[model samples]
Target: MRFFIVISSLSKLLKYMYYIYTHSSMVEGKRCMQTNESSKEQKVKVSGLTFAQLKKWVTVDLGMKPYRAQQLFSWIHLKRVISFHQMTDISLSARNRLDRAGEITALESCDTIAADDGTVKYSFALEDSEVIESVLIPDSPRLTACLSTQAGCRCGCTFCQTGRGGFRRNLRTDEIVAQLYGLQSSSNDRITNVVFMGMGEPMDNFPALSDALSIISDDRGICIGARKITVSTVGIPGGIEKLTQLDGQYGLAVSLHSAVESTRLKLVPVAKTLPLRELKRDMKDYISRKGRRITLEYCLIAGINDSLEEASALAEFAGDIECKINLLIYNPVEGAPYRRPDTESVNRFMHYLYPRCQAVMLRRSRGSDIAAACGQLGPGARND
Candidate 1:
């Protein structure tokens, strides 16, 4: 396990370079860069901001005292207040002013499913009416929250259902944070960890993703330690480079479903542009700079990427790079051509690669019954 987590923190893990998702209000089907004039006069959403950012906004923009900022922080985060009227300690006048200036953004609960395996999945509606899902995975005392970075995904990994639904707009910072707030309200087991491995690729919406990370990790806020958070990506070169620059506080998981170039291209269409060779270079650079090992995630699909030849390639690919190869059994997706490998095939695949790689583990899917497994999130699934 030493080689599995040679370096501390997820700062060195996850993400890709280049993004097609743009942050702009749709104007006649055109997307333009948002402006500082309140995004052309849209009210601020205070839910996802860090304490320092909240203080600056309250003191400067909202004309509130510095101490009042702390009060708002406690009201919103510690107390988990949903509306301004709930802040009884704050002056009525202040509450009225806050209502006029900004909103304490919260998601509207729509539907939820509890898997027999103790995995609870929640579907919430965003302000724009986009539906996103989050999963609460129970493992004894530790319950992990898998949050989404976007409403849908841009990286069209053929094996993933989220990609099949096509990309929607990138989530605002507040929307990203609100998922955790929504999950906490539903689950009794204090969320012990978070994984940005839900609906979309974390790197496609890097700006909002980065802001949500800081806000989530801040002691005055949600306070989930950075190391307990993991950001999984499809190995974007630019995103990997940027992840290395951040303070090593989180874990990194790259969804390298296949190591062979030809097979990987088919699995992750984005691989056509961000070839495997470059992805490895940045991964190596991430280790050298952050001194942390990344977890290479490979989802074993029947017949497609489960061959012994693929195992040999993966071993050779991760040979010099310090990383833990995490093997996953494919979870079924509706309308997808792929099939889950049988038990014997999975055993053969895992055994062949276990000795060849520096470190390896077969991470079982937790919520297949409720369609909450990895690569199974998206629209068009009828959950019972």
Candidate 2:
């Protein structure tokens, strides 16, 4: 039975490796096709297109005036109108044509659970009925929307519940943006900040994540400030390089739960593929070019990464880069072996890093009761 279990695990790993190899080529092929064909002719999501892309679809594909595109974009993004019929200024004929050609991707809120601390977790049902979770965290005078980039995570962080479910697929750009809009509409509060720190790694779904960032930060759309938006990743070097090339003052956060490679690899299985040294080099380059301080998110797990030695190593890792360290207590997930660090250990770890690190803050895990805290989103959650 032990040998059989080992073989089963090995087979799953091989399957995942094959998926990764083929997925890249598939994305590239799809991009080429999109560039060559008219977007309107393709069954594209209306919410995914930029103002410029919409304008091209309107003027070139639909044979309408360019001004109509601005009106359509305003209706969809600014007004947060979901239905084509609600676009009052757009002619009925055009609306009918649009209704037939494309769709506005929207997620239905199937379940909502609120914690005592005002953190609300939402399970949104996609059009296909697959569900993904997002959290709305309320800090006084600041409302932050935590959004997901993929349906489930592929990053096999041992402590993370989301990865235990395995990877489903990447969320479309519109699906990514819709979480913020849906949360704002439901809560009746303005989202002051948006963080890609839920469910999936933003870097793994770079194209969709990048497009979502563009739309959310666009002055003509949701218009959230680039500075207010933060994208967290498990230190993907290629994704960091791509983000640096983009034209925005976006915040970058790396999930470096441990500074030592051996410890990190044990915690985050994906770390073996992306070495700590290479990620730090990319992060340094990103900081140099952007002239901005990056954030390193470290989760303090009992008997795992929360130690005086680990804290010292982490401070040393943050030595070269301009960064702020956000130390989070591990939010326990069902069936996970790790536990949250005790108060004394947590305090000791923070104290050790205080002198060596420029800025270090111990962030309390919120919404744990509702299973909405960091690394606790997907275990036993209702999907249908």
The best candidate in terms of TM-score: 2
What lDDT tens digits, residue by residue, belong to model 1 across residues 1-384?
A: 776575533324421111223322221111222323354367678887778889877766654667878888888877789898999988887786677667888885798888999898889988778999999998977889999999888888888999999999899888988899899988766888999999999988888888888888877767899888999999765898777777755788899998899999999999887899999998888778877788999999999999999988998899998999988898888888999899999898888977778889999788988989899888975445
Q: Between which residue pairs do clashes occur in model 1?
A: 7-292, 10-250, 10-251, 13-252, 16-236, 16-239, 17-236, 17-238, 17-239
The alpha-carbon lDDT assigned to residue 269 of candidate 2 equals 91
Where is model 1 more than 4 Å wrong at Cα?
Answer: 1-41
Which candidate number maximizes lDDT? Answer: 2
Backbone collision tally, model 2:
0
| Regions more than 4 Å wrong, model 2 | 1-42, 381-384
